[model samples]
Target: GRPLTFPPGYNAAQAFIDRHLDEGRGDRAAILSRHGTVSYAELAARVSRCAHALTGRGVRPGDRLLMVVQDRPAFFYLFWGAIKAGIVPVPVNTMLRSRDYAVLIEDSGCGALAYSAEFAGEIEPALAERRPALVLRLDPAEEAALFEHGPDRFDPVPAGAERDCFWLYSSGSTGRPKGAVHLQRDMAVTSELYGVRTLGATAEDRFFSAARLFFAYGLGNAMTFPLWVGGTAVLLDERPTPASTFATIARFRPTLFFGVPTLYASQLEALDQDRPDLSSLRACVSAGEALPGDLLHRWRERTGLEILDGIGSTEALHIFISNRPGRTRGGSSGTLVPGYRARILDDTGAELPPGQPGRLWIQGESIASRYWRNPERTAAAMVGGWLDTGDTYLRDEDGHFYYCGRSDDMLKVGGIWCSPFEIESALIEHPAVREAAVIGRADGDGLIKPEAWLVLTESAVGDDALEQDLRLHCKARLAPYKFPRRFHFVADLPKTATGKIQRFRLRLGAEPAG
Candidate 1:
């Protein structure tokens, strides 16, 4: 985790893709998908062809190209192709609607859009609204024809480390998704610090992450981390259900598995019905949200594989604080990853003492320098080279950081600050509850009170008696004031594309039925 040194004019494509071939690993498998396995040589050739195809359609260095492809080998080709040709690739969530796509197209002012044919319904309307100069649709016939005509060996543009390489749109849990600009060196920094040092990834390992490549977590897990070490990545284009995930693991026998907490919960539930062979997995990672201690213990007991939960952000590019492979603490976010400096600061910008919860600020080379087209937000978030993470955390005496809720998510109840995470954790301990989300609901007097939304297990009945039992259960575990005043039985909680519970939507009076 020492600071990585890159020579002048570093292109991320060289480190992520071409380095494998340079090291005589051309015959090794680079990507595994439902279609088939692709070797390093084949992948590199396809990337070259993709770059050629883009350039043939008038793409140039520094041009912004928006990508809306699913999780497949094609995504890798398009992403690395843009980087190779010095075009800044902007990967977006494929689940977004036409309106969201329209906003992104306008915000990025992209010269071209590359999308798979499956997403034509969503992309066509956006394309009609904001007509970009070029659109590359990746239907099987069209894509194959383009690659067939394009050259298989083209020299990559020498984009300096400081040049923009890609942009990841925020999950928009709090507000509209903002484009976070990242440079060529940012990918290498995270791959070294978190992937190499923290996860202990190697060339022999096969990685499979349920998170898609568009999001920051999935991009690092399936793309950069494995590719950096000349390892193989398993890509799944379908929705990540427990059945599908376990089937992929059985088929691919991946050495590493990456998932969000919600997926882990569902997988555990699936294990109750049918336990798939998970012996191939050496480690499983959790992010996109905090992992509950109860769920972690259950997973370890069931699968015998430790879940390494970490905290990362879109702006930071990848995980800055994470639990290492053998040195994991069950509930905490482990220690700060190497190559990053973190500080828990008060509202006045003064550092807080250990064990005192405060705003978490981090400074690292991988952190994005700015938000695209939002100078005010960029200035507010990036203060003196440190990125304000907007999360509240406390460091214990053992140097491990514990997650409090987001600063905005924290509730002031009867002159006391309370974290919804604490209440949600306590609620999940109940046998009937499978998942829980707590949000502050305003009462008639305008005083904000804690309200709970519960997703019950299949055997649990949703009735007045069950509600009372859960209320009393919280009363036993949490402070009386901190306990949720109202409990709402829900079929499912609203979530962002990344699997984070959309508490803001719940707070906006999107009430769930009891």
Candidate 2:
């Protein structure tokens, strides 16, 4: 066994630019957006100027710098600038309401707030009352002027293994958001896992993912992974709708495409009518939810790319178990990446044998040190060196792991435990079903009964027989206790922006029992 370690006194991100900032790579595109392209030379200049501006405003090492910006060149510059100055950039979801913003701002204890002009209207009024001094705005003209007047380069700060690199806010479904803190050393672990083992990003590769930089998966895959391998990343400024995302792929011709299963479903829905040129896509990766086998098959058939399904959490920073490009198993999440280990264990901490579903526990160097300011919660989730992933999985005899529904999504039907994913995956196997979500509803007998919510494809519309046909499809594929007892047809399934089906919302909408 090999012990993972970071380079001695490493600030690799800044070191990368220190080695390349002067090199003439004007023709190499670092970032491409709908508005325009940003070459590596331009990006480095802006980052240096931004670093000087932040330093002038008293920003220093260990200070948390909060930023709210859409995916653009400015966002990238500010992020790298903060890292260069040894300040941690905490990027929040720009779509959050004022109250949500207030919670994150107060919780993170950010010293400065940075914003883009477009988001100023919504954020300015919210922060007007408690105005922080370092209110840096992302104006391209201002950045250009600053670069012209300021020195071309600044000495990059030296950061050791324990130095704080960045903070990622986890979506706290039950309570306030918790910041999953990461140290500088976590970079080496992440690069080895996602970069070398899973994605194998190289300087010649172009990586594109639907997740934004704020989200952990997106932040690592799009920003760190690409830069670690000296590759380019395509950032989508606007929301990644099915049509817009396809258009970007067609134009950019990204070598690697990353998204969730819901995004894949959307792409499949729109693919039949409008076939975008996805010929350049070399590999596809799906996360945030279980990638149903049927959806994987459909996407592969349409795009001619195999989707490598993965499972990860914010606590672990990113994916540890991901299907390798050439050795993808249609229904498995693949084997654990090097430098990480996963186990399926019961509540009592006993390991489960193959084919038995249990809570998945992951131990890795990339795991977050702890939840910020929440010692009790951190203690509850992290035991010894392993982090309880809260996800359920079953490993087959072949060592490939299959994702079951979340531990909370399990329901008891006639005293038999059932996973909603089993029902949903079976429903999706039907040709008429576009998407499906299965949740438990209390029935007349006072026992939880499984219900299916479905969005039908055009081929299945206006045919009353389609619903029964889908039911039969599930009946043939799954056990009787796991079949959906009720069906509700809808235009779309309720999902988070990251493409996770909101099972909690479904549980809220069920009819009250007598």
Candidate 3:
């Protein structure tokens, strides 16, 4: 990876937002929502006003502000406003429960909390548990009235690139979410490497991401990447159902669409019933999970757009290995993006040969400094500034990386290591299986064996015949030991807020009823 360089007194908001205004792109559309379009100058003014409002309320530099807003223009204002004011903003997952919010509030030690009125039910309970000094509820009319009194020309605080600007809680599939502390330059590094170099985004592009604002994937897709290129970002406040997603595409007509594999599968099913106008999309990207080859082929066949699957995490900020526009492989996460270096190492930490599965370690400028207040975990994961991705993968002879599941998700069956991803991929290949997640379930003999939870397609039955067919399907396709010993029919696999399958929950025998 190339050395990252930034000038003195650099702030991400200044680079992504203020620079557009300074470069005479003030009139260009910065955000497009159902309400209306906001130009770069309009957004900057809103940010300035919001900053004034925050400072007037006693928010200062280095203060932490907890943001629980949905995907809307106000989210943009509050986020950049906090950054412009030199306050570290922690954008929490909007789908979290009250207890989850309480965890973040206590962990981040945020002095204030800003949330939309719709989330008052959850926020109030959390506040009751751990109240901050300031609580700002953003009711539309009241917030407008409050912002109107704010100064229009407030100077942004001079925070350098190295300053801690924000914290994103890790998606806690393994345990409670940990805050990943990110510097001001982290977003810029990812935007440059993945957004600019890989995706080839331009000012003419309009970006729409199904991932929400709180997650690292969403922050980059909908906000940072688009703003980095002076492009327009489409914001959606509602949950992204297949119907809603299709409608958003029809209405917004964004050029670059981002989503996870689960959403992609849903959209494909929706498209099968009614093909909508997706002509506006030039490219689409998938992350949060490995996209199966069968799903990719079906999507491309239906939509004429190949989904460029990638592997990314909260710790590394965004996608480090991704399939590019013209250089995409069906099932492989493409070569490492420019400005990032990746290595595959064995259990002993020695570099592994290509085509051998091992733990993945990535080094890049965008990697988080540490898991906030978690010195033990940070010391274990971050070795000499190289982030242990905690994922198992192999680099093919062609230099493309293939995801073999998470390190903890891999199972030892019959004295051989087997990746659950390989089995899940095979299971999804069956025509009846819409989605599949495999985990190592202990049998009566105290031996770990592969078990699968499957979500069948709409027309598929969940009777003995169907299960038998699926078993035979895997038996014919996978190794003998890789075949699932038992299959559980499920309506949906457990997933995180970011749409990642929660294998740990399944491993702990938490499978929902069929």
Candidate 4:
């Protein structure tokens, strides 16, 4: 474990933006996007200019900048520039609808808003409800002129290690999103522990992520991980389908590729006909949702590269427990990261043994300081320097952590605790099943039983014969009472923006989108 230490006047921009140029990496590529390659020297100049642009627009220190921009070099420039000027930048998902934007606009109460023209239809309607003091569209010509008159020799803000630098809203897996306030030193902590120490990132490595920059996982994977070691960040601005991601990898030839479990499963399904040259990649990383053991083996068999599945959250900033390169287990989340502490606690808040399943709690320096303007939730979630991860987990005898499910997502069937993920993982192993989600539903006798919603493979049809085979498949792999009593062959499952299944929607009998 590395000690969290920083010198006086520890500004995040000085570390992530300006350090490369001071260390003789001025001409190196810092970002690669559709716009073009942005060198460290150019990035530094643009960031300084952006700071001047913000001040000229009446933005002051400690004010919030709400960014709904795309995954271009503009995103990097705006994010770093805000911190350099001592303003907080909050980036949210770009795939949301108009109503979503409206809620976020009211919740953020930011001084300025930056967005892309592609989402004008959604953002335009939201502005009628609430508008910030300043709004700018991220057009190339407009951005070029916005900071053209600013000086190039602007200095970084004098923010200390404990001062707030930025904010990231939660992905809203269960309810509304909460703004997580992060200090200036949090990103450096995760970059050192997970990126450099565990994954061996270096200046020569190129990084690409299928996840967008709004997520905590992606913020680390695409931005902090690469900039911490002066690596090049390869970015994509288009919607990430299997074809688009494969083309990006082939063109960029990145060393590390970050994706979620759903995207990996989809890519593996397309590999039979659309396999590309993946020789340049060292390995892939999976986070958002728990990675099934079957998907891991399938991906490795097809690509000859292992997928290091791990667990991270919006509160923890980045992965604190991950499966290392060659030390991966089939169905485990692997060991604790070097600078993190974990405990499994029962309902009474007492510690449980390694084999007993209970609530997961984590302690790390990179964890969020608190939620913005929500003291009640801050008190409930972050207490005594520990964060309740809101997940159910257990540690094995060999010191490996296993993910059960979200705390509320665990099922109680026949008066016994059961993890829906265990049943869903078993079902995903069947050849005809593409994806599966299990939830507790009442039966004819008013007793709880697992109900499986499945998305079948293209070659398979939902019929009585397939149903019988699925029954036998589950009965062989899971406990007798754990077998799903009802099956619904759905076109898709309800998932959050981060690709996590929304079991609560299924429990309410909401129709799955086609």
Candidate 5:
């Protein structure tokens, strides 16, 4: 791919919000939501007004504005609007405790806060704790009269390519989250590398990601990618369940769908009883976790569409290594995208040979320069301009990368390294199993062994007979020691907000969510 460039005075929002109008796509539908279809023209107008609203309230350039909003038209207006105004907007997960919101408020030291009324139970208490200088409740009047009444046009403040534009909190797949500060050029760089070159998105494409826009992967999938290509993006405010998602796809008729592995498994189970029209989709994408090979095969057998699964990080902004549109390999995070370089390295920092598992390191223009205010973590992760992904991977002879478990999540049994994903994927291959997670557990001898936790099918029973069957199932598919010594029938596996399995949570007395 050719190098991406911008004019002398470029704002990141120009590519996403303002570019469509410049390219003669103003009347095109930019957003499809439950509220209504929003054209690029209408979206741009709202964004400009939103920028004015912020400025009128004394929110200035370089000031952090904490956004605790949901997935809606308002999200687009405020997010891009703030960037256009030269204010850094920090959007966080809506489903969180009050303490979490409070932490983010204090962490960002934001001068302004915009929160949805729907989450007032959580947001209000957080505000009561540490209020910002400007607070806006996202009521009907707040959305329209406040932001909508302002001037419909504002000059986009020039944000050079090197200027910090936004901050995305890490998904906390391991434990603690870090704020990844992204520069202005990252938005366009990733949209070009992965969205256009890898997935082949264009104006004709309609995108619907089950993942919401607050997270890094979702930001690219639902917000930046579609906006960059001038494509129609479908937004859902409600949580992404099997029923809602299927119904949405049927009604909206999106050409490209994005989701995580767990949701795909659940949707496949629902397909066993309900057949919804998925003909509108040409390609489905999976991220946040490695989609099991067996699950990918099952979906292809049921629906003709293939899932282009890949790996990405909040630090990198979006997918740097991905399965190409027509060249997907189920278990592999396919070849690197055009602008990125990947390395599999040993514990000592030497590059590992092909087929050897090691920590993965990546280099790309979209990679975040550093974590906000944390010099220790910044130095550790951003080593010599390379981002240590903290994920263990092995590259096969075909230049395909296979995901092993996270570095700290790998288990050693009988002196041989075992990947939790390897056992989990094998367990998911069973007819009764819908999802599976494996973690190291200690026996009476104090030696670590594999323990399996499973979320079974609706009709399946988790009795002794089923346990014996699963034990035999694993014995036949995996190594003798690799088969789980103890099977724990669970309602669901604990997952992060983005749907990646929380193996660390499993190690802490595995309990299902209510």
Candidate 6:
């Protein structure tokens, strides 16, 4: 595939708003909600009103607007409001606890915040603690009442394509989250490269994304792509558990679904008991972690649709490697998407041949320029315009990428480096183990030894024989050096809001006492 380019005047992305709402498919539903469906005209008008409201509250071009809301109509309004005023929209995860939210609020350095009233109390004290410039209460119900009189026509500010657009933070699974900054051009690049080329989305397609809008994956799939193609995007205002997710899919009958690996796995399990009418789901995408081959096979068997897996990060904005539908391999995170260049480089920065394990480096117009306000970390993370993904991967002979694990997550036992994924994947293969996390801890001899924390499939408590049997199973499949030295039965593993295993927490559990 050839490199892709964004359309001219992309920074003025909202400039096309009138065209979308007027000349284009105005009758189509732009957003579907349980309360009501919003047409293209309504969504555009609300966005314009929100922008007017922000301006009246002292926000201006080049300012930052922090949005912490669920997948409601107001979320899109606030997002476009920021764009309309030439301000950057920084979305904070609603699933974060109050303490985490406190840290995020401080880190974002946003002058103003426009958030749902539901979360106002949770963040109010935190806001008081930091005291941002302005706090605008965004009650959707209240706004709807006021929308009756608000101006119907407003103009968007002229912004250049290279202007700073928005900021997104990492999930901070390891520690404090890092805020990644992207240009306005990145949004158009994502739509052109992924939406137009990879997804083949059009105005008629309805998109349903399980990932939250606060997440990079969700932002790209749910908001940017649909808007770019003049398609409709279904926004679920609640947290997407398997049950609620399927119910929304059934009601909306979305043409495309985007989710994380864990979400897909849980959905597959739910289908086994009582299936939802998902026939309208033409394409599905997975990210946030490696899609297990077992889960992939089972999902296909159940849904009769292939789950296309991809690899992405907040720094890169969204997916870079994706198995585009028809040309997919069930296991591999397919070749690089258009408009991007990827290389597998060894420790010393030499390019590695195909099939060799190395750190994956990617360079593209879509890549975020730097982590917001953290020059030292940014310098360490990105080099020579390439974003160091920190993921160790190998490209097969066919140029498809396979995730090994994070570079820091690689365990060193004796002298050889081992990927925790190998052990975790093997552990999950056992019938009794439902989920597993593997980490290396210092043994009595000062050598690193692998330890496994497992969530059992059934009640196998007090079964010493079962533990020994699992150990033997690992011994048989893995080399002696690679097998876990100890196993601990756990009810569940610590996970972030995105359902990613908090591997750092697991490592902390294995630490020896002072």
In candidate 4, the residue pairs with backbone N, CA or C atoms under 3 Å apart (3 or more residues apart, or in different chains) clash, namely none
Clashes of each: 0, 0, 0, 0, 0, 0
Model 3, residue 60: what's the lDDT? Answer: 80
Greater-lDDT candidate between 2 and 3? 3
List pairs with backbone clashes in candidate 5. none
Q: Count backbone clashes in candidate 1.
A: 0
Q: Against the true structure, what is each candidate's TM-score?
A: 0.97, 0.94, 0.96, 0.97, 0.97, 0.93
TM-score of 2: 0.94
lDDT of 2: 0.80
Candidate 3's TM-score reads 0.96
TM-score-based ranking:
4, 5, 1, 3, 2, 6
Q: What tens digits encode model 3's per-residue C-alpha lDDT throughout 340-445?
A: 8999999999999999999999999889999999999899999998999989999998899999999989998987889999999899888888899999877777
Stretches > 4 Å off in candidate 1: 1-3, 443-446, 510-514
Poorest 10 consecutive residues of model 1 by lDDT?
Answer: 505-514
The lDDT values for all models are 0.89, 0.80, 0.89, 0.90, 0.89, 0.80
**On residues 16-83, what C-alpha lDDT tens digit does candidate 1 reach at each position?**
88888889999999999999999999999898898888888898888899999899888898999889
Residues forming the 10-long window of minimal summed lDDT in candidate 2:
1-10
Instruction: For candidate 3, list the clashing residue pairs, or say none.
Output: none
Displacement of the residue 374 alpha carbon in candidate 4, Å: 0.6
The lDDT, on a scale of 0 to 1, for candidate 5 is 0.89
lDDT of 4 by residue, 179-291 (tens): 99999999999999999988889989899999988888988999888999999999999988899999999988999999999999889989979869899899999998899
lDDT agreement of model 4 with the native: 0.90
State the lDDT of candidate 5 residue by residue for 1-514, as single tens digits: 3358987778988878887888899999999988999999999999999999998889999999888888898999999889999999999988889998898999888999998899898888888888999998999988986567877888899979989999988876654668899999998999999999899998899999998898888889988888988899999988899999999999999999999998999899888889999999999999989999988889999998899998998999999878987788877888888889999999889999999999999999999988999899999999887999989999999889999999999999987999999999888899999889999888777778899989998889999998899889999998889988888998878887778788888899854321
Q: Model 6 TM-score?
A: 0.93
* Prediction 6 global C-alpha lDDT: 0.80
Candidate 3: where are CA atoms >4 Å away?
Answer: 1-4, 510-514
Q: After superposition, how far is residue 442 of candidate 3 from its true place, in Å?
A: 3.4
* Residue-level lDDT for 496 in candidate 4: 84
